[model samples]
Target: MKKNILLIGGSYGIGLELVKQLSEDYSVYVASRTSEGLEGTSATHITFDANTDSLDITALPNEIHGFAYCPGSINLKPFKMMSLDTFESDMQLNFFNMVKIVKDTLPLMTAGGAIVLFSTVAVGSGMPYHTSVAAAKGAVEGFAKALAAEYAPNIRVNVIAPSLVNTPLAKRLLSNDKKIEMMSQRHPLKRIGEVEDIANTAAFLLCEKSSWITGQVIGVDGGMSTLNLS
Candidate 1:
C-alpha cells in the first residue's frame, strides 16, 4: 500500500500546489472547507471546516506517513487598533487548530513520519502591524519545536515560515501591478513568492529526503526574514 499523507487544508494556494505535487508520489488526502483549485488532481477531498469541524480519521489510513497543517491567517493591524478578539481569533485558527489536528492524528502516524506546520516571516522579522499573525505563528513555531523534540526518532516535525506568497489570502496586497512591484521590491529576491516556491519546500520536508531534519523553522520567504538589501 502507498504511504498516506493527510493534509488539513489543501484546497487553495500553496496547500493546493503541495497536494498536486505530492499526489503522484503519495496517497494525498485533503480536508478543507472547499475543494476549489483541486480539480483533476489525484488527491482525495473530504469536506471539513477547521473552525467548526474535527478531522474524521476514517478517511485516513491506519498508518499515516505524513501530515501537514496548511491553515493560517494574515491578520494585520496596529496594536491599538487590534482588539483582544482579533488576537483571540488568530490564536484559535492558527495555533489551537493545529494542536487539535496533531493530537487527533498522532496515534496513526508511523515511525519516521513527518509533520509540517505553517508559520510566517513576521514571527521572527518583527514587521509592523503583524502583531496578531506573528503571535499566532510564533506559537506554531514553538509548538513544532517542542513536538519535534518529544517525538524524535519517530515522527519529525518542522515549520515553514514564509513571506507574502502570492495567494488568494494576499490578493488585496498584490492586487495591482504597481502594488505587486512595490511589495516585490521589499524582499531581497525582488519578487514575491509563488505557490510552487513554498510548496516545493513543503514537499521536500514531507518526504524521506528530510528524514534527519526536525525541530527546524525553515524560511521559504524570498530572503525577507534574514536579508536587508537597502
Candidate 2:
C-alpha cells in the first residue's frame, strides 16, 4: 500500500522538492498558499495558507504516515533595529503555526509515523543579524526534542537545519556572483546547498531507513555547523 503523507507549504523550495521525491513512492498531498492546480503528475495539490489558518485534516486519510512543515522566513536584521512585532511575527510563522498543524494532525499519525520540521544552521551556530530567525528556529529545535520524547514508542519527530540554499527565498542573498562565491567559501564543503540536498535528507527521515532516529536536528548544511578551517 502507498503511504499517505501531507506536505504543508509544498509549492516551491525545499517543500516542492520533497513532494517530487516522496511522490515517487509514497502518495503525497501538497498544501500551499500559491499552489493553484497540481503541478506534477504524482502529488495532489490543495490550497492552504499557514500564516492565516490551519488545514482541515479531517478530510485527509486516517493513516497519515508522514507530515512536514516547510514554511519559514529569512528575516535577518540588526538587534537594535528589530521590533517586538518582528520577533512575534517570526515566532508565529516558524514555530506557533507548526505546533497548531501538528496538534491538529496528530490523531491520524498513529505509531510508525514521522514528522519532519525545518530549521536553520543559525539555530545551532549563531551568526550576526540572525537573532530573530535563530530565536524562532531555536524554539522549533527544542520543541522537536520534547515532542519526540513525549511521543516515544509511537510517532517520530525530527528536524532538518540547512545552511544557505539556492531557493527563491534565498535569491536576494545570492543575487550576484560575488555574493555566491563568498557564501560558498564560508562553508567547509566550499559550496552552497541545493534544494535536492535538503530534499534527500527529508526523504530519508520519512522512510523506513531512519525509523530509529527521532528528535535529531540533522544538519544538511555544507559542513558549516561542524567543521571550520581558517
Candidate 3:
C-alpha cells in the first residue's frame, strides 16, 4: 500500500519540492492558501490558509504515514526596531500554527510515523536581524524535541533548520545580484541553500530509513550554523 503524507504548506518552495520528490513513492496531500505551482502533479491539492483559518482535518486520511508543516515567517529586523506585533505574528505563523496542526493530525498518524517541522539556522547561530524569526523557530525546535519525547515509541518528531534557502519567501533578501552574492559568501559552502537541500533531508527523516532518529534538530544550512571559516 502507498503511504500517505500530509504537507501543510506545499504549494511552493521546499514544500513544493518535497511534493514533487515524494510523490514518486508516496501519496502526498498538499494544503496551502493557493494551488498555484502544484498543477499537473500527482499530489492532491487542498485549499488552506494557515494565517487566517484553522486546519481542515476532515480532509486528512485516517492513517497518515508522515506530516510536514512547512509554513514559516522571515521577519528580519533589528531587535530594538522590532515591534511586539512582529514577534507575535512570527510566533503565530511559525510556532503556534504548527502546534495546532500537529495536535489535530496526531490522531491520524500511524504508529512509527514521522512528523517534520522547519526551523532556521539563526536559532542556533544567533545571526543579526533575526530576532523575531529566530525566536519563533527556537520555540519550534523546543516544541519538536518535547513532542518527540512525549510521543516516543509511537510517533517520531524532528525539525530541519536551514539557512537562507532560495525560495519565494526569501525573494526580497536575494532580490539583486549583490544581495545574493553577499548572502552566499556568509555560508561556509559559499552558496545559498536550495529547496532540495532541505527537502531531501526532510524526506529522509519521514521515511523508515530514519525510523530510529527522533527528537532532533538537523541543520541543513550549508554548514552556516556550525562553521565560521572567515
Candidate 4:
C-alpha cells in the first residue's frame, strides 16, 4: 500500500515542489489557500488558511505516514520597529498553527511515520532585521525537538531551517538583480536556495531511509548556518 502524506500549504513554492515529487509514489493531500499551481497533478487539494481556519481532520486519511507543514512568514524588521502584534502574528502563523496541526494529526500518523516542519537560518545564526521571523521560528525549533522526543520510537519530527530560498515568499527580498546577488553572496555557497533544494531534504526525512533521524534541526540554507567563508 502507498503511504499517505499530508502537506499543509502545498500549493506553491517548496510545498508545490514536494507535492509534485511525492505524488508520484505516495498519496498526497494538499491543504492550502489556493490550488493555482497544482493543476494536472493527482494530489488532492483542500482549501485551508492557517491564519484563520482550522484543518478539517475528517478530510485526512486514517493512516498518515508523513506530514509536512509548509506555511511560514518572512517578516524582516528592526527590533525597535517591530510591534507586539507583529510578534504575535508571526508566532500564530509559524508556531501556533504548526503545533495545532500536529496535535490534530498525531493520532492519524502510523508508527515509524515522520513529520517535517520549516524554520529559518536566522533562528540559529543571528542576522540583523530578522527579529520577528527569527523569534517565531526559534519557537518552532524548540517545539520540533520536544515533540520528537515525546513521540519517539513511533513518529519522527524534524525541522528544516533554510536561508533566503527563491520562492514567492521571498520574492520581495530577491526582486531586483542587485538584491538577489547580495543575498546570494551572503551565503557560503554563493547562491540562494531553490525550492527543490529544501523540498528534497524534506522528502528524505519523511521517507523510510531517514527513519533513524528525529528531533534534529537540519539546515538547508546554502551553508549559511555554518561556515565563515568571509
What local distance difference test score does each model get? 0.92, 0.90, 0.92, 0.93
TM-score of each: 0.98, 0.97, 0.98, 0.98
Instruction: For candidate 3, write residues 77-105 as lDDT tens digits.
Output: 88999999999999999988888888888
- Candidate 4 residue lDDT tens string, 157-224: 99999988999999999999999999889899999999999999999999999989999999998898
Q: Which stretches of candidate 1 lie over 4 Å from their true place?
A: none
**What would the TM-score be for candidate 3 when compared with the true structure?**
0.98
Badly placed stretches (over 4 Å) of model 3 are: none
Tens-place lDDT digits, model 2, residues 101-198: 99998988968999999999999998999999999999999999999999987989999999999998899999999999999999999999999999
Tens digits of per-residue lDDT, candidate 1, 1-230, equal 67999999899989999998899899999999998678899898999988889889887778889999988887788899999999999999999988998999999999989999999999899899999999999999999999999999999999999998999899989899999999999999999999999999999999999988999999999899888877
* Error at 108, model 1, angstroms: 0.6
Global Cα RMSD, each model: 0.8, 1.2, 0.8, 0.8
